[model samples]
Every structure is written in C-alpha cells, then in structure tokens.
Target chain A: MYQALFFLFAASAVGFAINLLIQRHPIHSALSLIGVMGSLASLYLMLGAEFLAVVQVIVYAGAVMVLFVFVIMLLNADKEEPSDRSKMAKYLGLPLLFLLLAMITVVIYRQFPEDAMVQFGDFPGQTAAIGRLLFRDFLLPFEVISILILIAIIGAIVLAKKEP
Target chain B: MPPAVILFTLVKILLLLVVLLTAVAYAVLFERKVVARMQSRWGPTRVGPHGLLQPLADAVKLLTKEDITPSSAFRFIYTMAPLLSLVFALLAFAVIPFGPPLTLGGVDAFQVADPDIGLLFLFAVSSMGVYGITLAGWSSNSKYSLLGSLRSTAQMISYELAVGLSVIGVLLMTGSLSLRTIVDAQAGTYWGFLPRWHVFPQIVGFFCFYVGAIAETNRLPFDMPEAETELVAGYHTEYSSMKFAMFFMAEYANMVAVSCVATVLFFGGWHGPLFGPPSLQVVLPLFWFALKVFCFLFVYVWLRGTLPRFRYDQLMAFGWKFLMPVALGNVILTSFVIVAWPALSRFWS
Candidate 1:
C-alpha cells in the first residue's frame, strides 16, 4: 500500500515538474511548481518525516511560491514568446534523456540492494526527536546555516536600498 | 486503511463543515448586529426579525446574483481563487480541538485530527490563504485589483512573520504544538483562583499574536487590501455573485479559526468548571469552548466599531518596526525564563 502511494506521488511530482518547465505563462508555471512541492511534501510524509513535510509545504509552497506569484503579478508578466527549437536539441534531446536515465538506473542498482527499503511509518520522526537531533547533536551546523541565511537576507536588503 | 475509519473521518469532516459554515454565516450577522448597535444604526431590520434570517437572505441573494467575468481576466484563476481562499481557511479547523476527549476515542472527540505539529499545520494552512487574495487580485486584470493585491501580499507576508514568531512563547510554555496537549498543560489553576493559562505570563506574545491575527484576516485597522476609500472592494473588485460571497465566507471562517486558536492558546480551551450529570459533562466543555470563541468574535466586532483603519504605511510600520521587535523580545524573554526559571526560584528559596 505504501509503495503504491509512494509511486503515485512520485509520478505526480515528476509530472508537475515537467509541467512547470513547459508552462508558457509564469503564474501557471509557479502553480505547477507549487504542485511539485506539494507532491514532494507528501512523499516526505510517506517517508515518515512529518515535520519536514509540513515545513516543506509552509516554507516553499506557501511562502516562497506566494512571493514568486506576487512578483509575476507585480510585473504583469505575459505569456512567453515562442522560441524556435534548435535542430541539435531536437535530434539529441531524447537520446540524451534516455542515456541519463540509464546511467541513473545503473548507479542506483549498484548503490544498494532492492530489499533495502523504507519501512512504512517505521521512523516516525516526531517533533521532539528532530529537536533533540537539531539542538543537542547538530546545534552548531544548524546555527551556522541560520546565520548564513540571515546574512543573505541582510545582503538583499542592502542591495535593494536606493542611493540617497 | 480501514473503511470504517475512513468513513468515520468523512462523517466527522462533514459534521465539522456544516457546523462551521453555519457558525460563519451567523458570525457575519453577529458582527453586523453588534457593530450596528455600536454605530447607532439599525442594520438589516427588514430581513427577518432583528436580522436573524439575514445570512440566509444574503446567501440566497448572492447565489441567485449574476457572476460577471471580465473579458481580459484570467478566467480559470479568477474562479478558483475564492475556493482556494475558503478551502485553506476551513482546513485549519481539522486540527482544532473544541473540547476534551470522549471515552470512545483515543484523541479528543471534538477535534477531527491531532497531528503532532497541529499548531504549525494551522499556520501553514492560514498562510496558504494569501494565494487566494493574491490570485484574485492579479487575475482580475484591473488596476485597483492589482494595487490591492500588492498591498495585501506585502501586508500578509510581513504580519505572518510576526504571527508565527508571536506564538513561540506559547510553544515554549506548553512544549508541544498539539492543541490538545497545549490545553492539557493549562489544566490546573494557579493560586487556587486564576487559570494557569499561558496568557498571564505571555501577555506580550498574546497581544502581538492577536494583532497579527487581525492583520492576517485582513480585518479593519489593518485591512489595506479592500479599504473602500482607496480601493473598490480590493481583491474582490472584479468578483461578483457567489464567487464574491465565497471570499466573504473565507474571511469570516478565518476569523472563527483565529478565534478558536486564540481560545486554545491564550484562553484555557474547554477547561471550565464541570457541573450537572455525566451526560452534561461532555456538553459543558463544548459550551465553555464555544463561549470563549464567541467572546472573541464579539471583541472582533467591538474593535471594528471602535478603531479607525490604519493607513497603509502605518500598517506596515506597526507590523514590522514595532510588533516584530516586541514579539522577538517576548520570545527571548520566554526562553530565558524557561531555562533559568527553576534555578532562579531555587536561589530565592
């Protein structure tokens, strides 16, 4: 049952990703990205990282994507102008895709045995467990990443400011 | 999954929706009546007795009214926006526990589901509601709508940070995000009188959170999106008929949801004195919960009647320059107390 559910979400995630790339209008593309984020969040839920899943939805799909959509609206971006597909890309794109898929499959096959799989709902990574790991074990790394993000935010603010 | 469990969940969801929708409809009327008295005006006297059936009348009118779609508007998004708004607004209720659990269930009987991160789930759902307003304004292809959407997006985004941050102090006290657990933590009273609610110590947090909640719902004093003086009905300017009704429904539903959360967080949820028979025990907690939520709704209306709307710049400045800093300070204070509190008490002893 879990496997079936996982496959369904996985398929949808990839499908939405492709749709995101192919959508002409920026808003639709943003919506498709949100779909991809949502499906991936579901996949994370199935993988037993419930906190990660919710955070994924709240941060990426909810907040970040809203900003992207807001920008699209603000700019009033219209449909993309159609571009001619290059002859080299048209001939070789499919072959390259299949080649990449085959290489990824081979790498996966060699990395682990088929029986090594995620036990459904086994590792219920509840909030407390993740908190202990974050604050106690990996506190430094977490703080470092947070500081890095804060710096980036300050940088953006500084950059966005106009000259007096 | 068991079919029985699924069936029961569906039944629970249906029950919740019916009660919630009816409550939201009446909440609008409640606001109108309360605000009317405050403003010294007779509001909707003709529709039913004392505007009792006014919500029903409004529903029928909106449903029967013509839905006009602009020629240049993005038809798909314009139509879907209100649904998105209302759905996410309603989704938060799934995790809200109205009362204590019955013996029949492992979790609270009044709540639909109690995930570990129930509070965060509510924030997430509420945050997603911004999309509806954003899309509605953007897809309308009208200048007023675009402007309103811009202000809304900025206002909601800025206030949301304060809202999220303001609740950290409560979480620090309860040590759990689950609404049921948080309420349970506030089970007993302090000094045999005052309820051991988080609101007492976390007053600043509660204040910030309440303000942020008001902003999040786009209520008066913070309602830049559709302030009638500047923007013509804001994001819903191009929306008409039932679609228009849906947006209002979303706003009211959001108000109820925020009220419920405040009751759960600051007010001790469903934790009142029990009296009467065992059968009445089950109903009494629900009564207390509803009473608390109703008071919140009443206060919401009172504020609308009393306060003038903030200017757009003032709104942003209040949320960021003042509210955010205060919320952050509250968080820091709460955490410091939590860590050093026991030792400090020991030192005094």
Candidate 2:
C-alpha cells in the first residue's frame, strides 16, 4: 500500500512537471507547479519524514506556491502570449535536456547497489541527536549559518524598503 | 489474522474520520457563534436549537451551489486544487494521537499510521495546503484572488521558520520528535504540582510557537491573505459553493492540525489530572488531550473576535523581526543552559 502510494505520488509529480512545461498560460503553469509540490510532500510522508513532509506542505507547497501564483497574478502575466523562441535554441535545448536525462539514468543504473532500501531506526531520539550534533559537534557551523541568515534578512529589508 | 487486523484498523480509521468530519463541521458553527457573541450578536440561533445544525445547513447550501469553472482557467488544475487542499488537510491528522492506545480483542491499537517520523509528516502535509489556495487564486484569473494567494504564501513561509524553531526547544527538552513519545515523556510531575509541561521551561519557545501557529493557520490579526476589505475574499474570491466550502474546511482542518501539534509539544498531550481507577487511565488521558485541544481551538476563535487584522508589512515585520529572533535566541539559550549547567539539566530528565 505504501509503495503504491509512493509510485502514484512520483508519477503525478512527473505528470505535473510535464504539464507545467507544456502549459501555454503562466497561471496554468503556476497551478501545475503546485501539483508538483503536493506530490513531493506525499513522497516525503511515505518516506517516514512526517515533520519534513508537513513542513514541505506548509512551507513549500502552501506558502511558496501561493507567493508564486500571487506574483504571477499581480503581474497579470497570464494573458501574455507565450514567448516565441528561436527554432535553433529549441533544437539545441531539447538535446541538452535529453543528454542530462540520459546521464542521470546512466549514473543511477551504473552506481545502483543492493543496499538502496531505506530502513527506519531509532537513533536514540531525533531531538537528542540533532541537539547533540548541532551544539557539541557542529556548533560553529550552525552558529555561522544562523549569522548568515541574519545577514540575508537585513539585506532583504534594506533592498525592499523605500528611502524615507 | 492479518486481514482481520487490517479490517479492524480500517474500522477505527472510519470511526475517527467520522468524528473528525463532525468536529470540523461543528468547529465552523462554534467559530460563527463565538464571533457573533463577540460582536454583540445572538450568533447562530436557528437551524437546530441555537444553530446546532448550522454546519449541516451550510454544507447543504454549499453542495447545492453551482460549481463554476472559469472559461479561461486550467481545467485539470481548477478541478484538483480544492480536492488537494482538503486531502492534505485531512492527512495531517493521521499521526496525531487522539488518546493513548486502547486494547480491544486483546490487541493494542493506537491512532492511525504512526510512522517513526510522524512530526515531520504533519509539517510536510500541512504545508502542501497552500497549493490549493494558490492554484485556485491563480487559475481563476482574478487579481484579488492572486493577491490573496500571494499574501498567504509569504505569510506561511515567513511564519514557518518561527514555527519550526520554536518547536526545537520542546524537542530539545523532551528529546523526542514522535508525538506519542513526547506526550509520554511529560506524564510525570516536575517539582510537585508543576507538571512536566515543556511550557514552563520553554516559555519563550511556547509563546513563539503559539504566535507562529496563529499566523501559519492564517487566522485573525495575521489573516492578510483573506482580508475581505483589502483582497475581497483573498484566494478563493472566484470560488463558489462547495469549492469555496472546501477552502473553508481546509482552514478549520489546518487550525485543528496546528492545535494538535501545540497540544502535543507544549501542553502535555493526553496527560491531565490523574485520579481514577487504574483501568480508567487510558480514557482519562484522551479526555485531557481533547480538553487541551478545545482550549486551543477556543483561543483561535477568541483572537478572531478581539484582534484587528494586521497590515501586510507589519505582519511580515512582526514575524521576521520579532518572532524569529526570539525563537532563535530561545534555542541558543536552551543549548547554553543544557551545556553550562549539568545540575540544572538533570531536572529536565
């Protein structure tokens, strides 16, 4: 049952992505993008990462996608005609995409091992493990990342705010 | 035997589903009544004795209403958005432990689908609900809807950081991410009569989590997405009848989901006054759990009544500046306390 749900979610994700690519209207594309996010969240749940799954839905699918659609709507870009790309650019892009896809497939097939199965285990406790690593072992990096986020936030305020 | 167990599980799930749907229905009525009372009105006093059947009436009204699709909208997406919203909303409750495990037919069964990483699962699915709103707004080709979707997206993303960070403190003290384990860890008392609630030790974290949850749910004061005067019903402006009703259902469902998380994390979920027959232990904990959840839900309605809607910029600033920093500081302070004072840390254990 779980495996089937996983496959269904994955298939829908791919289907949504294709729909996103093929859709003429930007709004339609944005809507399809949401389907992709939803499927990804489902896949996360199936993988036993419930916290991650909910966060994916709340943060990425719920919040981020809303922003994307909101911006698309704000710009009123849906009525705009699809960009007419040069025939040469389309031809070149198709092969590059195909090559990337083929390379990914080859890498997966070649490096595939018998130990691909994911096993869930209790590693003491999640909170304890994260706390121990975050503070004791990875303290400096964690603090540094937070500082980086602080900087980014300050930068965003400065960039977005109008001059008095 | 396997098939029997599966069938039993299905039966339990169906029962829970019925309860949840019923709860969701009444939750709407409750909100209406409370909000009305707050506004100095009689509230829902019709339908079935003091508007008891208001939700059913509303449901009937919604179902019979015309479900219209915009001519220019994406056909598949337009149809799927509400369904996606409702599904994700319902799924988040899967791992929520309504009460302790009950033994029936000599087999112990708890709530449905308690994956090892249950906490993460709730977050993942709950977050996915935004798609439905955004898609509905964008696909409808309405500017107001688009704006509402945008506000919702930004608000959710911004508050999510605070929400995630705030929970880290509880997770730290409890030392577990599983909801069941977290609640069980808090069963005993700390320093006599002061219950082992994380709320006491992690007060700042609790506060941040509470505020962030309200924002995350798009409730009052933080409900910029659906500011009627500003956005004209926000993301679902173009939705009619049942489609619109799905959005409404998702909102309440999200509220319940977050409330459940809060109950488990901050308030000792399924842990309450314990003075009964030893056999009644199982049932009492669940009662306490429901009581705590009801209190949180009441707070949701209360805030909606009392608080004024926040300006968009002010809401963003409050989340990013005030809430996020405090949450981050609490985490750091918690880490410091745990590291610097071994004597103090022993009390937490």
Individual DockQ of the candidates?
Answer: 0.79, 0.49
State what share of the real interface contacts each candidate retains.
Answer: 0.69, 0.81
List, residue by residue over A56-159, the lDDT tens digit for candidate 1. Answer: 98999889998999888878899998789899999999999999999999999899898887677767678899999999999999999999999999999999
Under CAPRI classification, how is model 1 graded?
medium
Native contacts present in candidate 2, fraction: 0.81
Model 2 accuracy (lDDT, Cα) = 0.81
Measured over all alpha carbons after superposition, the RMSD of each candidate to the real structure, in angstroms, is: 1.5, 4.1
lDDT of 2 by residue, B1-35 (tens): 57777788788778878888899999999898889
TM-score of chain B of 2: 0.95
Docking class of 2: medium
Alpha-carbon interface RMSD for all candidates, in angstroms: 0.8, 3.6
Off by over 4 Å in 2: A1-17, A27-70, A79-164, B103-110, B278-280, B343-349
**Model 1, B1-349: lDDT tens per residue?**
6676677677778888999999999999999988888988988788888879999999999999998999999999999999999999999999999988863433335889888889989988987899999999999999999899899999999999999999999999989988899999988889999999889989999999999999999998788999989998899999999999999999999999999999999999999999999999879999999999999999899889999999988999999999999999999999999999999999999
TM-score of each: 0.97, 0.84
